[model samples]
Target: METTLHHLHRPLGSTGLNVSPLGLGTVKLGRDQGVKYPNGFRIPDDSQARQLLALARGLGINLIDTAPAYGVSEQRLGPLLQGQRDHWVVVSKVGEEFIDGRSHFDFSPAHTRLSVERSLKRLKTDRIELVLVHSDGRDLEILQHSGVYEALAELKREGKILGYGLSGKTVEGGLLALEHGDCAMVTYNLNEQAERPVLDYAQAHGKGILVKKALASGHVCLKSDEDPVRLSFELLFGHPGVGAAIVGTINPQHLSDNVRTAAAVLSQQQ
Candidate 1:
């Protein structure tokens, strides 16, 4: 029912970044301590991870999403992606860190600067294509009180980050961040659509939009005969401003299925 979809490289708003319709989220690649995934699993070893990354790229995936909150994901990718850095759009986040099976947040300007530098190191690269404030759901408070956005902007000016934004939870916070940053990553799936307004604002303002949990974080279960994945993808792709949907899956077949479903959706849209 689905085919290839490489023609769907969309612009990530005005940041001048182009990304495939589906992005590979790397949360499962690192953290397993407090994951909410419907299924429990082991973290893939480097060789397995490398295989998955290569398979993703072969399937026309160019956007790889990670964060300091994802345990060793950033660090592992640094070495695994050796000799192939520029081929991918590397996106990392600050403010949230996964440590000792617990999560912590630090949005101070100093920590922000330090975090960006650490990411550059762990990523084994000199520059990060995009960095976002990994908001702790108090998106508005973080935007107003925290110096994180300011720090990322300075880094962008210094050529450390090409652009910065908020992986915010609230629509208002996302819109607020876009006033200062390049894009916003928010949740938008069949099960949750409250944040659709953020996507609307990003579309209208020419700011970028990345969809997280677009498949309901692997919990979008439906009847055996129902094509939930296809329906969910259609809802996301319906928004022309959605640069990509960040789906985390360790299964190569699942990744290919997502790509094919996107292609089918794109075909119908045409």
Candidate 2:
């Protein structure tokens, strides 16, 4: 007989970090102009954002993800997370900036440093727990020539970031990120599995793995009586290398449902 094990949270690779099975993404809390949700939504005000964060904590989510490409998400989080900073694992990204309703990329060493500094200021933190290179899909080129990876590693050495990884769009990029950094964020959903190799490498190497679009960004369609959300977690958490699935939602009810589904899958996993 095999001994069953239980875990309330999953480890982020070998980074010596553990996060809730569900990570709260703050994009919807700030940006709504170019979002791809099923329906339009009003950007939540500060009070509403705070309430969502509180609800997330109560539901056992410990990871919080935001990005500079997310319009005002970093700025909004700085003030809202004032006294509760120590209790969460915050993940932010560099290499992309959203301005004037558009996005632009810069991964030069100078810009990487500047970006991290700006992120620190905007997030009201001296150090970020994890930072990932916001990739531009040129996996091979970015991994080989971008110099952003080395810059982030230097920041980690200098204690500005605890760890750095790649939020990449290609398997090669994800593998290179794991080889050089601490983790890799991939899009693994019921509808897609192209990045399975990256997750396999993480599992083999004891490195971190974060899922970006576990539910296919709400593109999942149910057949018969299948629950897409539940199935997403069943496939996502079923993989031991997956640290957490980052889901961006401002609706409190939807957030609750996500957490509930993740918890159910984790229980089943044990």
Tell me, by TM-score, which candidate is best. Answer: 1
**How much is 34 displaced in model 1, in angstroms?**
0.4
Candidate 1 residues lying further than 4 Å off, grouped into runs, are 222-224
Candidate 1 backbone collisions, by pair: none
Cα error of candidate 2 at position 30, Å = 1.7
lDDT of model 2, residue 49: 91
Instruction: Provide the clash count, candidate 1.
Output: 0
Error of 2 at 193 (Å): 0.5
lDDT of 2 by residue, 1-270 (tens): 211112477678888888887889989977887777777889999889999999888888889999999989999999998999997899999998888888899999899999999999998999999999998888778778979988998999999999999999999899989998899999999889999999999999999999998878777843426899998888888888888899988888888878777777778778
* TM per candidate: 0.97, 0.95
Question: How displaced is residue 1 in candidate 1, in Å?
Answer: 13
Which 10-residue window of candidate 1 scores lowest in summed lDDT? 1-10
Q: What does the lDDT read for residue 218 in candidate 2?
A: 75
